[model samples]
Target: MSTVMVRPLLHLIPTVLIIAALGLSGCSTSKPLPRQTAPPAAVQTDPPAKSHPRTPAPKITGKPKTTISAAKQSVLVSERNRASCYRLQPGKTSTRMIKKHIPAKKAATAAHLAKKDATATTAKPMTTVTRMVTTTSRCQPQSLIYARCRTGIDTCKLGDTSPVQWFACAKNNSATTFEPVAGSVLVLDRNARRGMPTGHPVYVEEVLPSTDNIWQLRISHTNYDRKCHLDQDATVLFNSTEMTASFMTGPWAPWAKDLKALGFIVR
Candidate 1:
């Protein structure tokens, strides 16, 4: 009886040992559970860009200022006046008078043809050919003056008188003075050598600043060249003491030395 019991107990002990060994092997071979960490901290990022406000440009209020020199101003004024004067047209009567005064062209002499004579040395007469040349009048000084100075002069009183006759009309109707002034009529005595057969009358456009005591005048006239052409802004020098004016620069400057200056006619 003791043997049988002891054998059974031994068999039971072996079975229990095998089960424990199998449990230990399974635990060692199997992988351990991974440690849990707080979810990766949310990645920090820069905030979205903000829109910027636009700045308004300043507004301009008025016209820009400009600086002009005195000489320039004078020139601008003279030019403006001259342009205004040019816009005026000569009256029909004045135009007709100027055209009437235009000199007629002389007839051309007959052409003489000489032929050889076998019998004697004499010239043979042949039919003559005649040619005539004609010229048209352009403009006259008085007409231009009347038109330009209509504002300052009485054209009706002046009528169609030539430049030479303007002195008396100016003296009677206008104030004659030695002091040269703008918008005045300058009267010069006749000088055949200077080609001023009908004296000369010019309109004073401006009285320039003078370095010397003498007055420097800017004048506008026509027909001084006898071509019936207009000239403007001609420089002239006036001597109050001698009461004379000389052309400083112009077509007449070469021939006109110191012509007698009657005076300036101001209305």
Candidate 2:
């Protein structure tokens, strides 16, 4: 065997130092360990929800109408039409239900029956109405009115409210009515002032007057609008009679009487 050589103490001292470092490695403070984090807990979540909602309506329609009922009809106790119980609404241009006219056949039958029923009837001529009455100055008779009369007649008295305008009677001067005749008293209607004063009444003793100078028959009129009695059997009148008797009367009589004495007649 070869002879083993031993290094010096200095070299042996370095070997021992290296062994000592390996032995002291457990005391290091810079080493890291494995992380121990808790596991993630069970995840909890909510389910989804809902929103809003909806609904619907109803119906109607058409035109209005007009009608007449039984309650609207008239019930007359004394009806002219015994057969027809009710009348409909009349047309604007038509007439209401009225008295029925006789048919032509019915009229002919009535005429025939009337002819058989006819008796001997007396026929007489219609004469003019003649009358006389006292009157005052308030009765001014208008002679200018065109009165209908015969050729020789002097006065016209037709007070009917027709085509013929007549003079009113003495008593009816203020009334709306009158008579038709010569010599009949005529009155001015309370409202009859056609050409004369109203409320006037006068006498028409003569329809025609006698002419002057010849004393013959002629168409002349003399109206006495006013009259005053002079005395018994004497009158102070305006016209006619060819006399104006004033037996010691007043001045008013003389004025009228003198005119009578002048041959001016009073109607």
Reference-based lDDT, each prediction: 0.63, 0.29
Give the least accurate 10-residue stretch of model 2, judged by summed lDDT: 54-63
How many clashing residue pairs, candidate 1? 0
Q: Tell me the spans in candidate 2 whose CA falls farther than 4 Å from its real position.
A: 1-182, 186-199, 204-209, 213-252, 255-267
Per-candidate TM-score against the hidden true structure: 0.50, 0.14
Expressed as tens digits, the lDDT of each residue in 159-226 for candidate 2 is 42321133332123442222212223233333332222333233233233333421211121222223
How many residue pairs clash (N, CA or C atoms closer than 3 angstroms) in each of the candidate models, in the order given? 0, 14
